[model samples]
Target: MMIPIRKEQRQENMHLKKTPMTKDMKKGMIEDMKKLKRYSTVIKSYSYMKAFRLLATSLLVALSMGFTSCGEDELDRMPSTSLDEGTLFDKTDKLFSEYIKDYSNIKCRYGLQGESSVLLSGLKDNHLWFSEYDAVSKQLKSEWIDIEKTDTIQQLYKGYGEYETLYVKYVAPLYYKEISTGNIVTFNIGGRFQTIFTSNHKAKRTQLQYDNSKNGIAHNWYKESVFIADCCYSHEGDTIYIAKSRPSFDENGNLAGVTLVSYEEGIELSGRYINRRSFKEGKSVWSTYIAPPFDVPSDAKRNYTLLGNTTNIWEYKCEVTFYDGTKRDFTFKINIDNGKIVTDEIKVTGISINENTVNLKQGETFQLTATVQPDNATNNKVIWSSSNETVASISQEGLVTANSAGETNITVTTEDGNFSTTAIVTVTSNEDEDKATLARLEGTWDMLKCYGWEYNDQNIKENWEENVVGEYIFFEDEDGNGGYNDGYKTYYFASSVEGNKLILRNSEWLDGKTSIIITKLTETELHLKAIDSVSEENYEMKRR
Candidate 1:
């Protein structure tokens, strides 16, 4: 029952001129043809009916031309070869048979024969005259031709159609139903029609069966096809098509499987339509869910719960059931600035730190934990920072280390919601106050300059100067564990302070041991003199 139309052939034939018939006419003719039990007799008489209609049209045109040159008396006389409108209407069956031949020709041209034929024919069934249908058809055909000639438009059409199919098949049916049944109601909002569901008509579970053999044919045929040229309703008069745009895609060019924008009469309303696919008995089944529009129905089920709010934005959660008995929770963010509503998956509401206030001695460490509300938030990652790293420093993993006798705030912020929580950390020093110098070195330092002389093999000191001002080093703790990054690779080392000298030990260093005399150390400035067997280097640094 599936039509096997080749893409290349279809593209080639799209430019060919043929009889223009709207999908509705094709369906009507196909249905009327099905009603006649004597199809063979109709086929046998198809040629005669076609020839008769052509002869009738020719005679009518010829008679009009002849009458233009005739006298008033001659116009009153009936032409022998011409047939009147009444006589033409009398042979309705013959005219209907002629239509059958036209429909058959269309089917043969488009490869619409069985289920594929029915699926394509049943797309849009609006009543329109031949001229009107032809104009619309030509406009849509030209748009499609342009789309085929452009890669971006072609991808947009394919992506849009994929999501639209899911919307038309699953989501729209549950949300927009019969007006007479009181399931849906339409409003004339700003000169545009907006439909919404009623409160009591919740979606019910329904089992659906689709022929697997028709999947490939239907999907491919519908991918590049748009049934209606303008804003129109489905054949059942329940669902409406207002606007369409390309779906979002990832950097790798994979479709995001969601439509992010919808327009109604030039008014842009942001919404998301997500397409979900599943299989049942080797048959493909699609399910889609959409966010509620800006204007929610007054009588709709009011099950929304306030999650959190800011000065201008309020976030709420609502659970809705689909036709397949599956329930989904959505977060609605209402912005007061433009009075617009947007929906996302679950979002972070609030955050909390384990310890509100903590007291620690110098060189002590404690792990501070942060908990994001509603556990299942879409983005729960938090960024950790310290208000004053000199008093206390916090790691990316929330490990706080007390440095000197001071107080600081350790804060954690949620990545998605920017919700933050802080813990006050106080450090009391019991060791010698000179150890406070280590606390001053517990942060990042920018190297100002390094100048020294290297003794060559001849034992002569050669001047070696280098500007390393852009380089940076991070001192983690009093124990002298630190890292240095010169805009390329970072090197880690352990150090110890002996009197006025700082000894650094690292296997990756040029020498296993290097000692530097701390010439100057302060809250803001650091100057060191590195001494080796061959040369001595003076380095200057500043606290960052």
Candidate 2:
């Protein structure tokens, strides 16, 4: 038969009722109460056994006295005063119930339950001790759990026992999750990890950020709230973390605080950052240098710390990763030995231009260029590229040339591999084809050799120098030679009385004192001499 419940409390049990002590029931009844005494918080009088038996028999007889509504769940129970805060803890082997009290009294907001929940009976830094009764065990269990484990595989939908709920949300677009806003971050936080300063709001405000850095390559800072996912930045402009990534908006609502992240730089163990905090004003830099990891032992990078209310000197510490995964350290330490961060945090900001969309005309060439500079950064390196090789191609140093009639785009990517963009290129045909003049200059000619020199007074025959390529000038028997470039001296062919005659006239710059000569026009042989005034020089043309 099912065990009956207490009046007005409806608690269910698995006990077998003994028939009131007839001669046979007395001995068994004594043993049962003794066993009950071993587990019960309240001890009943040994002498009252007979009276209890009578009372129990009377209760069974009055079946009309219906059972009360007691439930077996520990959460539904009234405060158990019979519980010896000391012995109750010794049997359960943990302090889950006590954890609720200390945890709630500390008023930490991050999911530690209130007084109505499990009480924190004990604590060690990062390890917690609390107590709660398990229904199946029918006895309160004092629980001591490791308090600092925070990495995740899947997710815990809710908390243990009747404690506050906990969950996780992966915010990144890739299968790899990103640190997102509104994600509930829970830690094994031991009982001792609790403090008077403990507050759930303070702990969960730790936000995770997607940083372009080396040391902490796979991790993010869980140090702030994430109200928005994407942000816009200017070329070398300051990215003010306004309510959402903008700066200074006392009008659109003022800044609660700032988020400054950098490459491998993590939160320094000294100063205000050593102690964690929620988002607050002047707590960060306007610029963040996210490239390396801090002094911590993990690959995840974004480390954060708090700053004092009006200080401008934000110091930071960072680690440089060697090519083979080893790390070196750097520091921007703003000493807060006075127990507060007496400096302002700065954020390093930048933007990348899209470069994959370029167009051009046939036979034209261009140089591709990439520029990466921070609003406060110096000596930043950048890379450039193109979209199509068939239509247009770009050089390693950013030179581009259009090879075909089609269109293509050019792309420019950042060195950090954080961003990329493209530009358009359109090509048209060249329209100046008529101005070329080298189509008719193909021919062969040669000079001739002669043995006899018949020049009187060393005068050259003028007709011999006509239709030539070399520079020449016409001169008298005593003057210099004829001119060419500015104006070529003329070799005039005259037919006086039907006989061919030649005259070398120094025209343009040369005066009337010039030579006259005559020779039959031939493709390969010519004999000539200069005037006596210039020189007694004979000229011969020969062809091979």
Candidate 3:
């Protein structure tokens, strides 16, 4: 049923003149055709009613042309020729058959013949058109071609006719229904408004699909496909089309050409952000910016036209009339200022840090994270800094280290707008002194000098320079529970401390207990004298 019409062949055939018939000859044509004996009876008698109607209309048109030619000069008239009745009827039948054949070729392109229905016919069923107007003068500026029409109800499920068989095998799955009653066509278009352009417009375009369940927003744009010329793009890092220059229209009602638009280099449409109340735990909870509507009349009858300019900001107000004769007005602004095409409002509420206040001991570290909101913010770059570096220092990657025991503020600022939020950092000196003292005593020590005093001897302990000299000692803790390790023997004892004194309980020997008086304890030297009921031992040790 899809008949392809060759334009060149059609033009050539239009110039071929048809043979003329006089008014007197047309009156007896049916009877004369019936008298032909060589042809079938059906063709001779005009058995088909549809075919008969076609023959009658064609004969009447030929007779009318013949009468009009009679008024011309006699010298311009061509001599008439006689034709057989059978041949004349055959030629007329063939012409009527071709006319019926051409009528059977058109079909709906988007659906199956027996099961599908048409939502909006791409060919000429338009009731509303997109129009642009001047903001200052309020006059019609440019007009585009009639794009599409809205429907009042769902289409009936009638199958395609024999002439519409071209749609039988091509069934489209997209379900879109329109209900329009003179105005206000309400249909779900994924939060996107439909705009049609001429074939040769050459402007870059984005087609967005809206679905609430898929996108989590009231009117979410789920998918976007950008197009330039005949090719389409959807990959990341592609050049984004922003605004467009006005189009030029030809006298023949066609789009002459178009110019694409690019955004500014450094200027930005500043976004407002806020902190989110509900978010995942342990994650930064920043809010995102929300964009306002474009604010053009959604359902209007005016056709689309070119804009006057693309650089300055333009304020537009649109009025929509519903089917019941009720009206509503919407106003929004759009402009290309400083080489940037921007909408009116931005919707970033605030930013939030994962931890508002963090407590750490000196010389400890913790990581901090910050989030930016509205999900689609143009600039999410954040700057991380600390108020006092002596108290705490933060890395560019948001790792905060406590230097000394003090407090500071960890601030995260947005690079584009300078919006900032802070986290309080508190570092305390809790057990750092005890830990440092324990660290200093945890190494090997060598006994440099030793002395012993017998019970029978005099008042002071005398030096026994040859005893326990050059012996290696190790202190596992500040309690000092280690002894000399003479190559073949490993001396062991339970060591602990009471204030500054070191106590060693030697379980290897019965009643062997030593309490050493600490005279000097430095990084290089340690001097101690242990006295018990048996004997007094004085030892001087040096770190190995």
Two-way TM-score contest, 1 vs 2, winner? 1
Q: Model 3 scores what on Cα lDDT?
A: 0.40
lDDT of 2 by residue, 1-544 (tens): 1222233323232332323224333343233323222212111111111221111222222322211111232221112212222222122222322333223221111111222222222223322222333333424343323233232122222223332322211100000111221112112211101111112222211122222110011111223222222221111111224222223212212223333332211222421234222223324332232333234444434333443312323455554454566656654534222223323333324445535455555678876556554543321335556567777777767778887666677776554434555667666543211111101111221333323223445465333223334533222222222222323344422111111222333344223424434343344444444443533334454423
Report how far off residue 207 is in candidate 1 (Å). 99
lDDT of each: 0.43, 0.31, 0.40
**lDDT: worst 10-residue window of model 1:** 143-152
Models 1 onward score TM values of 0.21, 0.20, 0.21
Candidate 2, poorest ten consecutive residues by summed lDDT: 169-178
> Which segments of candidate 2 are over 4 A away from where they belong?
1-11, 14-369, 372-422, 425-544
Worst lDDT 10-window in candidate 3: 109-118
Instruction: Indicate the residue-level lDDT of 187 in model 1.
Output: 16
**Candidate 2: how large is its RMSD?**
29.0
